[model samples]
Target: MNTTPAFSRRSWLQRTASGFGALALHDLVQAAQTPLAVKAPRFPAKAKRVIFLFMSGGPSQPDLFDPKDYIKRMHGKTISAPINTNELRVGTDKFLALATHGEVKPRGQSGMMISDLLPHTATIADEISLLRAVHSDNNQHQPAALQFHTGVTADVRPSMGSWISYGLGAENSNLPNFITIHPDSDTRLYGASFLPAAHQGTKVVIPQGDKQSPIDYLADVSGDAKAQRARIDFTQRMNRRLLKGAEVDARMEGMIESMEIAFRMQSATPELVDISNESEATKKLYGIGEKTTDKNGRACLLARRLSEAGVRFVQVTMGGWDHHGNIRDALPKSCSETDQPCAALIKDLKSRGLLDDTLVVWSGEFGRTPWSQDLSGTSPIHKHGREHQPESFCTWMAGGGIKPGFTFGETDDFGFRPVSGKVHLHDLHATILHQLGLDHEKLTWRHLGRDFRLTDVYGNVVKEILA
Candidate 1:
């Protein structure tokens, strides 16, 4: 003490500032370590979790779920149907030739008409509620995909998964609330725009084989656990010292939370992805060993495990459905890759008693036109492919509060537009929120001096489809 210099005004001020910084750092560290605690919904929610099976490119509805008897009769004949002006226009032509493939048969006890292309899905038709007249405002891939996932065609918004995560919080303290497998490069499908950063989806590349980890970054690069712990502790402390506010900064909070989750994920994700422990019989049921269904089979099986482990929302994407040309060759291959695995996931969920509280959704962005895109007006050329049609499409739901083996809404005779029971994209979002015990009208976040909701102030829950 005698050797120490006397404190001056400048020294005193510097010491006090350092101390304040340390206090702020402490606050940040605490925020980082905070775990996701399960929260109650606005009301009693029927679904504990949701698994969205998103088919990236639009699957043709005229050739699949919505069967029009007149398409075959009017094949290669010019027909005019009321087309939605908002949808993408193929060309200047007013009328186009009609065409359809695949046999539509009544499936399951519900007598819902499904195309023969999805034989496995047909088996579980009774467990599904098919919305045959789903429509949207966009027909292009990027915009339509945006609308389907975020309830907006152009602007960045919190995705449906992010909305669910924000509403109910996370079920598992160690796992992320939202996870996307093989997510599109387009971040809008899963981004948490305007929402808390922690609500964003965690993306994992699809596992190519049993040997690889589901997430490549889950493993620690350094072999020293003690060093890792020390580093984490130091980093957290430093981060805390930089934070200052009545509340911890949101960005700092998310960064800290992500670090904690990543550390825990190092231990949890590997075991979840390793399917070698699964029985041969179960693997066969999911068509895991088969060449055609292996990729999607693994994804679906992982979805089941993640849901059982209490992940709030898991989205699995299957791409390559843009069949504008040679649709006859492309559609069946897409169906072959998904059908068995999709059906198996439903059956597995039901067997585990998870189906009652797990909501499963399958849908594409929009649908294909019933009329062919005749490029040349002179000859009947360019008749092999169909244009984008946002007027009508199909989406199916199973489990949770959905009415089983039911079909709602109807398209016109040519499957061009919804004539009855039309369900808009906003309504779909509202209904999904309703099942998760959220009031779409009230589940909103205030940003830029406005209260914005997932439904964007436009949606009525489809009560008729509820069980």
Candidate 2:
């Protein structure tokens, strides 16, 4: 009865449904074509870009930024056990108070307490806002780092850089919105889960040799730009034909966009990664030629360069701060490798007048305990190191809308817990988003029928630290 003389009802409905699908596919194709195109912020922004200096292993706060008088007085003696009894620890059962390996004296006009191990950082103490009681939930490396980047410790979620990339897009169309230099092996630290894959951070390495490309497989093996373009055009046509037949394919669209970016990057990235054009003065400022600081110095310098070139977010990770034995001998080495490069980044940005619109953050996942921890259980007091402490740590922010020369938060006498002005990692994430003109609560993406955000239903901006 349905096929009385012509087309069946089922065939007609199928044809009409395909036309509707094509209409939806058109919108997705247009969006993928310019995914990184710059978008306006929700409001006026104090910072246009962000540079995150990630200290991978937990850096000791008592040894680097905070020193407690009570802990010093009770050095080598048993103090009240402030840690939870349920938690298992390798050493530090005796609760022997560990004094700071070096002195932390007041520096700059701000009277910010800094260690002698970071002389370069001390020089810029007046330009930074030191947060002495920053806390997080996890103690393990991977999960704590996940919390630091994704706000939740247990699940895979969009990272802060990826969220920022989604929010503001990119100021430079030729480059990615998010780039991480020398990141950890874990991809989750910079992943863009549940978001467009285009927002995922592009990993880069500072080339050790003259001919090595900073990005893997960057060199065009075809040897002809015209031939490459022709091949890409053909491939894109095939991809679009495949996309037209699908209901929805965000990953397919992302791959299309990524391939285009990779083609464009073949021309744009080489000049940015080459540091030879930089002046001798600039090179020396970052300690580029020195053997002790060469690796990190190159990474930091590259970060500044990329930031200046309009990359929305850049991260540089420096590790080796996990000290469980012979801390006095080890902590200084870690400091030496990173101190100058980090401080130089601030100064270089300031000199270029970029600091006013750039937010620079320096922090680790957590901090070390004030009590001695000897994993070997046979080391002396001076040789013993500290255990992981997620209760309190130090994080510093510079430029953007942050108040320079200001110090916020305080910890208990034992340096085990926050006593005042506690700023959780969630709060830090909120404040950073706020400075960039994104309300942490409002910048969200819908997934699985619920709105997800970087702060995840928590976080309050610490107004006192704002300029």
Candidate 3:
């Protein structure tokens, strides 16, 4: 029995009440609390929120960030190098070719050695810092990503974005403080679980197409504006009545805030998502035109727009990095999609002087392993394949309070594990929160009779990377 029916544009718009023109998108999803309302930082705050770029499908570290001297130590190892060198699958072979292509050289004044695949990012090396020793607990997909986004890698905690929204009220009264834009075939990437429904990212502008106007209802579902007010009032009354005896319902408060902001967005979102208002030059710089019109570029452009409009957090999620095989062939396309716009976004932010206050993070759930999955190959490099590695990887930081042009931490010669300045996922989260003026350890909710925080009991601010 096929109960699912075909979806049309009109039906889609009506079903997804969120407007198309990028209206008060954050309000679309209700949150349990506001992160902006968290206590002021003990010291100076560097950033307000975060723009997290999640590269799902785990990118390989050796091929991308850390080409090591240790690969030679294990020469003759054979594995499937998924891409350019795909035919090189073998067993019991040593040393996979350190990197598929060119070397990762020191760039900018900081001399951070980013792989050649990320040439655009190299230009701004002096403005960014790289964390080379990020190790996670898992090798699987959903679990790792979930743990990365939510503090409980075990699948039982609130997400960092959700916690931030909970701690702080929205900075923009008319918009949701936290927003996420992920272009994928699935919805779970941005779905809200225990967090208040309102706190979840409002998919203001889905990645359908230009005419889709992701925010269709944004203009007004009704001909009469005042009539809209009546609907909001009616909904609020129902919520208030439903929880009449509740001691403290953060979820309900989040709902109230969302509704209020939605009413206000009727006047704001259309303008914010309108690239027409931006200079043609700016669009060109973002690679919105011609040959560079890739999905990742569009996301980067949207991220810049959202941040400029005062969005507290604008997460641009680009999945499909899982290069278990064919890495050499896939990396070029993957790099093509991201390399340019990411760098452009930074340059644009700096030009607008927003970089100092806006923080950008590029990372994945975990890195791919140095050894091939089968552990038996003939050549130093596999046939463009790499296995899962929870031991070590890299992530980058720019703007906010991060020290630019620096590479923090180190991995063993084979890039198998972190040997210096190891920072775990929780520590990273804590540091991000610290920059936004909240103590990750202190910003907690009493759930199940215990105080649960974004960092839990572990996590220390990596002060060395601070500006």
Model 1 RMSD vs true structure: 8.5
**Which consecutive 10 residues in model 3 have the weakest lDDT in total?**
19-28
The segments of candidate 1 whose C-alpha lies over 4 angstroms from its true place after superposition are 1-35, 84-88, 91-94, 209-212, 246-248, 374-383
Per-residue CA lDDT of model 2 for 351-453, tens digit only, reads 9999999999999999999999988778789999989888999999999989999999999999989999999999999999899988788777655646688
For every model shown, the clashing-pair count is 2, 0, 71
lDDT of model 3 at residue 255?
Answer: 69
lDDT of 1 by residue, 332-427 (tens): 999999989999999999999999999999999988888776455454433356778778899999998899999999988888778988999999
User: Which model is ahead, 2 or 3, in terms of lDDT?
Assistant: 2
Q: Summarize candidate 3's per-residue lDDT along 302-355 as a digit string, tens digits.
A: 788888777777887777677766566776777777778888888999999899
RMSD of each: 8.5, 6.7, 9.5
Cα deviation in Å at residue 178, candidate 1? 0.6
Which sequence of candidate numbers ranks them by lDDT, best first? 2, 1, 3
For each candidate in the order shown, give its overall lDDT on alpha carbons: 0.80, 0.87, 0.69
Positional deviation of 86 in candidate 1, in angstroms?
11
Please state the error at residue 169 of candidate 3 in Å.
1.8
